[model samples]
Target: MFLAIRELAHAKIRYALIGLIIVLIASLIFIISGLAKGLSADNASAIQNMKADYILMDTDAELEMTKSFISRTDLDNVLQMDGIEQANSLSVRMMNASVNGSDQNEDVALFVTDGDSMLLPSVRDGSPITQEDEAIVDASLQREGIEIGDRLVFGEESELTVVGFTDSQRYSHTPVVFVDGGGRETINAIAISVDESRADEIRNAVGNSFDMVTKDEALKGIPSYSQEQASLNMMIVFLFVITAFVLAAFFYVITLQKRDQFGVLKALGAKTTYLAQNLVGQVVLISIMCIGIAMGLTLGIAELLPEEMPFLLTADEMVQTSILILIVSIIGAFLSLIQIVKIDPIEAIEGAGK
Candidate 1:
């Protein structure tokens, strides 16, 4: 890598541009990953925030909660099981929300559940939305400048009062608003707290009959969850692959430019294996720098956005994604190693434009 570093230092502009591209590309990978994760979390947060071990959804419905429906009968059968402590129903809907008549309306995901449960978490403002005129909004939504006691229009037609707020219970990429059960009786699904053995039994008995799932599986029930997640993930995977090819191609070109240097080193008794390893090592160094800058940039950008932005970065996921990008970036450079070992000293020195 000494040779590669020396070459990069001497041609800093060219190398820096490549590194910048790598940085931008890696940042994009991470930003999209953050967005994907944020979207997943936003869409699934209500379910994720559930204090339950299991969530039951409509069997005929795919994995999305938006498409699911549960009956009072469905509710009763589960309650009858031993070790199954309790269950609560939820209704989900997407609605248009506007504050103070500004062009600032946003889509809010409606979480229709009894507000009295611990599963709903605590309030950030006003009070728990225990009544029809009362509703608890997520803090992320409240940060949009609407506040406690302010009103938000729901659906294509009218509005509902913002009685209180909570940071918990986000669903399908929108902040959650908890309302009374009467708001939407065709409740979307149910959250169930169960013993491990009971979960298995319930899963086997009623699940096989009515078609239900745990929380994770219920995410697939969202109308757009599976398709959108799969599409975005495919793009991320392809982008990573393209990044690897581009890095390898850049390094391969760099190696060719340094063929005479490699010949000289070889002529001085350096092993081809050592020289190849050095090239791979250089790629690793550049990849690390690139990934680091990408993360810094993501943090910087997230801060610059308005508070209303749905962008969120989970610490563990961000760390995991960064490592994965670096690993792939290094793999990209390793592909260049093949070119490093193929250089012929005699041919390179003979100057057939080697």
Candidate 2:
């Protein structure tokens, strides 16, 4: 530890540059992770937070929710099965809506369900929607100044009254409006919140009856969400791999530069295990510091992003990935140590020329 620490302090300029590169790499990995996570959330937040154990959609449907439309009879069929606690029919439509009295006709998405079992985006400002024309806009939409009691126009003329504000609820990156009732008269899907014990029974029964789907199978129903998430995740994986390579390469070069010194220590009877320990210790220390700095920087970057950017962070993902960075750094360090094995102890002496 002392030798490794002293080396970094003595080579401040070189080490500082390496630290900066490492910081950037960590930042890149961390930010790409946040963005990837955010993209998945933006594409699936509403469904992710729904108050349902199973979602009912048509059998053999690509996406069981929006694209798979079922009628009231289909919804009724799901409720008849034993072990079904409760069910709510839902409809989601992609269309443009705007702030009342504002010119910005943003792409507004609607989640329409019967008033009995309203699911995503619990009520915050006004009452859970009861009437056909009443709507509860996601709080994000409130940023546009569409408040309760305001009239929002959906699809040119379908006027919906903003009855309340729900928090951070979105579907497909578009802000959601929760309309609790026949949902403009179209029952596209149903949400079933059932106890786990009875889930299998209900799933088997309803699946046989009404083409019901569970949460695991339902996410694909969203338009392009799977493809979008896959693409972003690939980028995130690439960034982390690239970070590991960059850090490994930097340390690899440093190990080469110190090869003669390492040889001298070996010739002085210092064990190879000790040299390897010191080298890896330096990398571990730098990795910890660099990742900590990058984490702080990523937070700043996330805050700097606009609210509408769909940026999201979760403690689970961040913690899991932070550990991943450390583990990957160690992996990188091990790879760089290949140079040490090839180093000759004679390099430490006066050489054969003497």
The model with the greatest lDDT is 2
lDDT of residue 137 for candidate 2: 78
lDDT of 2 by residue, 1-354 (tens): 888899988998987887898788778877877777777777777888887877777665655466666778776666786777888888888888765746867687888777666484678877777678888877887777666898877656678888888776778788888775653434777788777898777766765545656665677777788888788778877767877787788889888877778888888888888888888898888888988898889899988999777677777877888888888888877776888877788964555335
RMSD of each: 3.8, 2.7
| Poorest lDDT segment (10 consecutive residues) of candidate 1 | 179-188
lDDT of 1 by residue, 19-73 (tens): 8988988888887887777777777777776777777777766656667777777
In model 2, what are the clashing residue pairs, if there are any? Answer: 63-221
Highest TM-score: give the candidate number.
2
